[model samples]
Target: MSFPAELSAAAQAVEARLAAAIQALPDSRVRAAMAHGIHGGKGLRGYLVLESAALHDVPREAALNAAAAIEAMHAYSLVHDDLPAMDDDDLRRGRPTAHIAFDEATAILAGDALQALAFELCAQPEQPQAAALTLKLAQAAGAAGMVLGQALDIAAETAATPLSLQQITALQNGKTGALFNWACTAGPLMADADPAPLAAYAKALGLAFQITDDILDTEGNAETAGKRLQKDAEAGKATFVSLLGLEAARARAQDLITEACDALAPYGKKAESLRSAARFVISRDK
Candidate 1:
């Protein structure tokens, strides 16, 4: 199958797993909001989990939960990020944001539930490397990583001066790169192998992804992006594009994609999907 097809298949499998998990919860507005929050994403992070798992020869059954867990965590982040006090986004995944679809309270509760569920899924009794994976995830998602990046981002908005390119890179590394690192390394952790190569790949991929995102915010169509675009520019915030300029930002993203692909050399041709994914990262409009 083609890379896109494989990615879609992986997404469907992860989505099914997430839906089943959510369905088991007690019925409430929060439950409904949780479902809404997880719907319609590209599931790229989950795809990374499954693909890296494949590279490590881990069984799909063993890895599916991890993939689902990452997607759930990612969804939760988006739900909360779209809250009134955060990015204040009104649309997500081509539909109303969770806070808009449900009430703000329900959205907050749903995000909280999803994040808790992510840890539960990763630390399931029968899961391989359950304790290790859970610990790593906690570190990746907590104050040292994603949250720290978020705090930096929020602080940047009010700073007297725009952030430097170096500062933005550091912020995105924590906010975006941390989860990608976890997803890529989860397979190796499960198989008790070295995660260095995929970790390196993820670092480059994550930065490239953010650069492309910044580029899209400047040049992409809001209708196609399925959310508000140019918000950073409108807010007068510094971004990769604002710092590097459009052509330079695009070129830098391409270089990072190459670096990401090069990091996959140990897996040889078996890693073609990941290579394709790297290329797709910069090419995607959304």
Candidate 2:
């Protein structure tokens, strides 16, 4: 299957920006570790930032900083999530995870430093909307968003009953959807334009992404996934595939992808890359 050239270009641009941003950090083992964590990925969130910014005619100077910042933040999340206390993974991106490559202390510090750098980059945007952008990022990654979702996930393990569908949706809306929302609407937000359409797109795309993740967990191999798979089942976790069954979950993801594309109807041809991204969410192997 042919992937869209536009998305590939956007991903490359974001990857370069992320690398440059990390290279500018002050020299230290932690800095090196931070760079290591940021290296290599599909770079979907950062690509969304750049593409959305382009749609709104936001300059590269402003968009690059925001794009790099989001990737930095995402890298931090993965580093921490792979810790012994969290997802407890030893592999990521087909290599040893941060904690495994470096010591636990170094990995912890890498995550902390990368997270700080994310805000620093956001603060330096050429546009005057730096403050607003930073605020949204904080809200998305903080206790009100991704952290809240993770906390809910951890707590759910101890609950006597499994989380309901509604409960899971609410949790994932923060954990996964919030970043997508920020990425998809970043250009509009920076330009002080309406974000309703992109927000609607992200809501559907993010859910589809998570549902596919659940499906992958059930049927994917760790080698292709670059990390453990089927662990959700091993942990007896509630997931879309577990709740809705395999075919149902796949159908639901397809429906959501269609919905996400529909949300971009106003943008027409300008949103074709974003539409491709929505499809990629479900089709990715890792």
Candidate 3:
């Protein structure tokens, strides 16, 4: 299958796994909100997990679990990120935000539950690499990783001066790059192989992904983006496009994509899917 087709297949498998797990929970408003939170995403991170697993010859079942875990974690982040205290947006994936779909309290609980579920999936007894994956996941999603980036972002909003380009880049490394790091390294981690190559690739891919997001926010239609656009500009926040002109930002993203693909050299032709994924990151409109 081609890259997009493979990505879609991976997404479908991961979503199914997520839905089944959520379905097993007792019916409640929180459960409903959790379901809503995980629905309708691109599942890019999950695809990366599966792809990396394939590259390392990890078992399909274990890869699916890992993929589902990351997707759940990502969904939880988005759910909370849309809260009134955070980014304060409504639309997500062209639908109402979880807080709007349910209530603020339910959304918060749902996010918490989803986060817990992520670890649960990672630590399942059947997986041989469960312990290592769980430990790394905690580190990646905790204060040292995604949360740290978020805290930095919130701090930047009230700082005396705008964040410098370097500062924002550091913030994004945690906020966005951490999970990408985990996803890309998962296969190697599961297979007990060196993860350096994929980790390097993920670093570049994550930065490119965020730069493209900044570009989209600057020039994309809100409808096409499935969320608010120009939010950074409206809030007077600095971004890649704000720091670098549009042409420059686009060029930078392309350069990062190239770097990401170059990092895949160890796998040679076997990594074309990843190369395509790197290209897709910069080309996507939403």
Clashing pairs in 3: none
Model 3: per-residue Cα lDDT at residue 88: 92
* TM-scores for candidates 1 onward, in order: 0.99, 0.96, 0.98
On the 0 to 100 scale, the lDDT of residue 76 in model 2 is 93
Evaluated at residue 219, the lDDT of candidate 1 is 94
Give a tens-digit lDDT track for model 3, residues 221-248: 8898889888888888889898988999
TM-score rank, highest first? 1, 3, 2
Instruction: Estimate the TM-score for candidate 2.
Output: 0.96
Candidate 2: misplaced stretches above 4 Å? 1-5
**Cα lDDT, all candidates:** 0.94, 0.87, 0.93
lDDT of 1 by residue, 1-286 (tens): 8777787888999999999999999998899999999998888999999999999998888799999999999999999999999999999888999999989999999999999999999999889999999999999999999988999999999999999999999999999999999999999999999999999999999999999999989999999999999999888999999999999999999999999999999999999999999998899878
Q: After superposition, how far is residue 124 of candidate 1 from its true place, in Å?
A: 0.9
| Candidate 2 lDDT score at position 281 | 92
TM-score between model 3 and native: 0.98
Question: Total backbone clashes of model 1?
Answer: 0
lDDT of 2 by residue, 54-159 (tens): 8999988889888888888889999998999988999898889999999899999999988898899889836548899999999999999988988898887777
